[model samples]
Target chain A: MIDEWYPVGLFSQLDPAGRQTALMGEPITVGRDAEGNTRVTGGNGRTLPVRLRYGHVWSSLGEPKKELFAIPEADQPGRRFVDVGVVRVRCSPLRAVENFLDVAHFPFVHTDILGAEPHTEVQNYKVEIREDVDEVWATQVKFYQPQAAKSASGGITTEYMYRVPAPTCSVLYKTCPPRPSEWDVITLFVQPLAEDLCDVWPWMALFDDTTSLTDLIHFQQTIFLQDRSILENQIPCLLPLDPGMEIPTRADLTSVAYRRWLKRHNYTYGAQLVAQ
Target chain B: MHSDTTGSWTPVALSADLPAGTVMPVQIPAGSLALWRTDSGHTAASADRCPHRGMRLSHGFVRGEALSCIYHGWSYAQAGNCLRIPAHPGLVPPETIRVVTHMVEEADGVIWVALGRPEGRPPGLEGLVPLRSLTALANIDAIAAAAGGKTSPQGIVEVASGTGTICLLLSRQDEDRTLIHVLLKGITDQAARIAAVRSTESLRRKAEDIHKKEFAQ
Candidate 1:
């Protein structure tokens, strides 16, 4: 059940300091030894596999069947890779990733900053499960962004494309204000601390070089913090695949497809199969 | 008129702790409750879970006199009646859309919630005032052992401390923890208040240590 690699903490956060954290509700410590290698110890000094990627330290309770998902844009030169840090959300890990995939809450939760009233319309988007890579993708998602990016001065219609390579991870490619041709990549890596709780680590690789590091971190943190209250207060806490507990509109197609993919993979770690 | 099912009273929290237009989670003998106070200084206690999708009403917010769920902004009155459904503003919610509520009584800086009919009112701290409430990672027995006194039938355990007498009103929380509300018998000065706080903190530490040692065996 713990065969998949889940991120425990940021590599930077662990390299400089030892952290007491949990992975799938198992208390574990994340730190580096004297030889400069990642060390993870669970209850009663049980060690697990440790790896560093995408500015995060990942560990698996059991042998992972696959390596960490790839983010090619992270290594691309001239792109500012900003680590937005972690936020503990009292909701399922899959729910955190699905919320990142959702653009419908922009006007309601992120009002005025990302979207505003009267502009709260979600047009049709294409969603599918890619057979070759066994991933979920949603494309051609166009939304009116009051501030498209940190570098944007005015409103613009932003285009978004979402990719879900892992059950708890999702990547978003959105329209960049500075470079019209290139798309900014924002990725959410959720660590399921328990079936009803998770820690979300959001990383961004964008084309803009103007915004300072603190501003970039703060801008993303504000948006995520605004969402944290809503996530924790949701019913059942775990992500419900059956949609019986909730009413889905036309805009929830991506979420529906993602749930289907998760069910197909039998990723029931943080998923509620029934309505309750 | 309240029935026999709404009579047994248990001290849930302090009146000062729950401010106006705020909701807090509380646990009693019956179960968990959403203890809240309206803007007009009226208090209420409702079943912790919401009726819609079972969201914890304690995690919800209060606007004016109504408690609104944080998930979808479903508002409910202090009398356990549904007032507003933000998603469907035009439609009037049916009478069955109501939450189970308990009878609440606030007296002498303490708030008591009732699940069923009781013979008498909650114990009145006539001269004592509530200083603070702290959770101890120990059971009631461990806390009583640490205080060198037995808990009375009224849930009051008096400990003779160097800073005079400190009375702790214990409430069971979860499995191995106790919510202790510290009440000062006579001391109410600034220095005495600080001393009472220190005494309770020391008691909690000792109780937790005792509990850990006992469980480790």
Candidate 2:
């Protein structure tokens, strides 16, 4: 967890006035200099590697072996890029990512907005590790959403594709209403503050011209805030890698695959080895 | 510190803060507590963690007389017994599936939580009435020094300001923080009440500064 770059705060959250934030349980200060360049100081009063990418301030406490993962849709023009800001979640970062990948919760946690009763069936989906690139992907995921997008007027069968490029970053591709040919890219970047606490940063690149930016932001915030209560109230705030405590059915294939990938990387930063 | 199992009543909160059909988390010398009030306006305190999966019962919602966990909808009665488990509606919950409970007493608009079996009721507030409650980032000694008074065994410290006599009821939240409930001794007007509030704020600032200095030395 230390070697990898984590999103500390949004680019807009930082200013010349300066602010203090925490990453990986270490307190850090971020500010701008006279020339308007970003300056960061770690908990030990030492310089840290700071990078501005995808509208967030990324920092690494230890030496990072690789750069931040690239989202090709972010560079495409005419796509509305939104910064949903940071939301503090009282659960493990891995649990947040895992919850984002599971569509079965739509009928329950996100009722009426994402899914409603009578259409709560989760069809078969394909989950693969993609060993060539060392990333996990869940494809052919289809779910019915009463309001799929901010611009959507009616219910539609929303097709989703989830990609887990890193331990705490998850990108979702969903069917766009305005641009039916293309898909909307929504990403969740989690900064694990502690083993059982995290700050989630959600960014989206969508193809919608009718919806206002404020409405889009509110829509995403409303959806995520509904999940926050469930996330925090979950027993054992840390995500348990073992399925012994929980009963996973066929609908939890994606969650199962994600757990396997996390286990493969030995990403126990916010993972509980056993159910406590 | 009042660490005795009995005769130790901690003023956890004000009666106005916790209304009917609501629950909140509280910390005491014994451990954490899930303080809740039923729809009938009866207050109860239970061990915070759920017996099912260790979920904080403070996060649960109150429905009528039972508190239901948000995770799996496991409801517990006011007596800390598991009333119902949503997953198995037909099966009766075992007797062991119950949380530890504590004695609660509400008087003079202040909510008192007992650590163990108390021999008698909570200490009387006499004619004093609770005004407001606030948390200070200082221990009992620092707070008493700032208020120019000594704390009694009952955790009541009387502070005299220019406006009136304000009594500070202290409850140790942790090592550094103390929960203080402000009470008025006599009938006061609006202006006097405002002054009491301001004086309490000043006392908190002074006590925090003294605490910082003590730590530094």
Going through the candidates in order, the fraction of native interface contacts each one reproduces equals 0.16, 0.16
* Interface RMSD of every predicted model, in angstroms: 4.8, 5.7
Q: For model 2, what is the C-alpha lDDT against the true structure?
A: 0.83
Q: What is the lDDT of candidate 1?
A: 0.83
Q: What is the lDDT of residue B153 in candidate 2?
A: 79
Query: What C-alpha lDDT, on a 0 to 100 scale, does residue A248 get in candidate 1?
Result: 50
lDDT of 1 by residue, B1-217 (tens): 1124436667789888999999999987556799999999899999886776456789888989998775445679989888966534455777778888988888899998876766567767788789888888898889999999999877889987555679899888766878898888867688878988988889999999988888433
Residue A252 deviation, candidate 1, in Å?
5.3
TM-score list, all predictions: 0.69, 0.67
Candidate 2 chain A lowest-lDDT run of ten: A243-252
Give the distance in Å from residue B104's predicted Cα in candidate 1 to where it truly belongs: 3.3
lDDT of 2 by residue, A143-192 (tens): 88998878888999999999998899999999988888999999999988
Count of backbone collisions in candidate 1 = 6
